[model samples]
Target: MSGEAAPALGVLRRREFRLLFSAQAVSVLGDRMVAVALAFAVLEIGGSVADVGLVLAAGTFPLVATVLVGGVVADRVSRRAVMVAADLVRVASQGAMAALLIAGVAEVWMLALLAAVAGAATGFFGPASTGLLPEVVLAEQLQPANALRASAVSAGEILGPILAGVLVAAAGAGWAIAVDAVTFAVSAACLLALRVTPRAREQQSAFAVDLRAGWDAFRSRRWVWTFVAYFSLVNLLWGAWGTLGPIVAEQDLGGAAAWGAILTAMGVGALAGSLLAARVRPSRPLLLAAFTDSLFALPLAFLAATSSVPLIACGAFLAGAGMALTISIWESTLQRHIPGESLSRVSSYDWFGSLAFYPLGLAIWGPIAAAIGVGTSLWLSFGMAAAMTLALLSVPDIRRLPVAPPVAGEATP
Candidate 1:
């Protein structure tokens, strides 16, 4: 909450953090390309908008189903080992998809199946990666480290779509996906080169018992649930944007290119926001974060209420900014507040709760849109997201989340 700028660049200069950053950056590029290729591949194979929905939902479901287990694994096993395994699994799965497409034998089911597998790996990877950050960087640098990651992700999102558009148009989606698979391999290599020591596992238990212990951590925290409940509602609304927004773009807004622009603008905004977050920490971290989430729905309101490119772009930018701010605060709070041993498990619970309804939102939004209208669906999403933000901000615990004092030992966790 201090006005002084945090030394974000100084943290990046640390050798171990640099390695982690490099690996994450490489992996993010591949991740973004997968999104681009998946959407295009569905369209190329004569799949409907509904098929796209199914593919995306399939990809996201693993996070909801496996996150808790992933957390337990992160807490019990070496975080580096878990990350290495995840990267390898992604490489194999993505490579198979590329080969299938190259053979001209690709099917929607294959795409969906591969996506699900990759998602499961990511479910584990996300928690481990998040939990591992404090181990690699100074406690005071947590916000900046997270900001750098957000910027990297935004950079990938911005470039991947444009690259995929061009690559799929010229070389085919299969080749584009192959490029993504290669990036994963490179990411693994970067991670393997890290020099940091893994945290010693002081206490161990059966996996089932550890799972229950993680649950206990969640049950003990009021702020944790307040954040999770609000995000659950926010993510449900996002599911509508994810499932229907692209279809609306193709049919009503403009086309794939238009959607790409909208998304790219948001990515750029996210990068800007991340950079801003590195220097500015909010006093009311949760309140600011939840309130900013409402901006995500602004574009929906604009698109639903009227058709204007500039307005939509504006809304998307604001939403992206909000997302960027929220990520930094949320990650820092979780790292600082939760017991390091139980951090990943608590994170898994947060992930599961926040995203549990996303697929449901995606699945139901299509039918709801068909029944009433896409515009009406947009209106409904706007209202829902706004309501969730308000409800989250109204919680006394959310408004009172404690910022942990700086650790007195070495900056490393």
Candidate 2:
């Protein structure tokens, strides 16, 4: 391969991996598109500000509740089948939403209900996705596969909102959402085309038994659980940025446009980092990942210190890169270290832990800023997030996990 060629090119050249990768890229675009459009859709329907929060929460809570179950299901059956089913369910939910909105018959309640259903399906699709790559690619390909996927996600974050904004302006939120629904259908079609390495099943165990096993698997891995613990705290603490950043931007920076620029910088950084992750082979994977994750503290710190849009945007960019790099390495780590048979189940716990505090973080931070000044609150949140990452780095195992083995022996990707 040429030095300039993406390491992912080799992985993407394979038929099955290409299908899976295409499916991910398309679906992520849809996911990002709907994220922007959904709020506007609710507003277009004459929803109250409270109704907007309600509708979003309605979607988010179900995904959190059911992701574990989805993980268990993915483990028991084909990961491909699990993803296809989840995509179909999302297709139905998003498609219904688009239809109702386009028909001008959509209600706040209807959007919330459908969002909940789609969220539940998303809970399933996510873990299955992390589990599926090992089924399609070689062991050495896991890093590139995951990095390429992250790149797709980063690109979607940048473009999806732009597309949604344009569509909402030119046509309506309904049209943008309809495009999202189409992406899901496209994902389902691609998933249906995949030929994966199949696993032999033993007699199925009870659901509770399977869930317990997954929990055990997660809790047993110190590196996994420890970092998840770190994320659980930091993700919540970082919520302050999400809650306070906008308020600060409006007060100090130029407002929405400035905030949007900051976000766009972050997305660009993520794209850059993911591309780097594809090519850079770290000696201590977990350690590098963990250190990179500390950059997450930047936006909060910069926002706390100054109102300068350029400085804050710079921080946001690095933070976005840090986030993309962390996740790419983390996903690769999970796929390489964890046993394949129960990978989805274990991944569910990871997802569950990481997200568990997010809503609470978002909810509490605004109130906190109301009590203290936004700067004080932001600084505190930054301190906490930085401390968590530092404490996580102190752990020995984070530095222990090595690069991929030169050859696959017992471990087949």
Q: What TM-score does prediction 2 earn?
A: 0.88
Off by over 4 Å in 2: 1-6, 40-53, 99-110, 169-172, 241-260, 303-309, 369-376, 404-413
lDDT of each: 0.80, 0.83
**Candidate 2 Cα lDDT to native:** 0.83
Cα lDDT of model 1 overall? 0.80
lDDT of 1 by residue, 1-413 (tens): 34444387778788888888888887877777766677778777887767877888888898689888999998888787788889999999999999998888998999989988988988888888888888899788898898888888888777776777677767788988898899889888888887667678776688899999999899788888878887887787887787777777777767666776777777777888787778777776776777766677877787786666677878878878878877887888788778889999999999999889887776677777878888888899998787777777788877865466336672311
For candidate 2, lDDT tens digit of each residue in 188-243? 99999898868989789999999999999998878889889888888788767755
User: Which parts of model 1 are misplaced by more than 4 Å?
Assistant: 1-6, 405-413
What is the lDDT, from 0 to 100, of the residue 144 in candidate 2?
92
Residue pairs with backbone overlap in model 2: none
lDDT of 1 at 374: 80
What is residue 296's positional error in candidate 1, in angstroms?
A: 1.3
Clashes of 2: 0
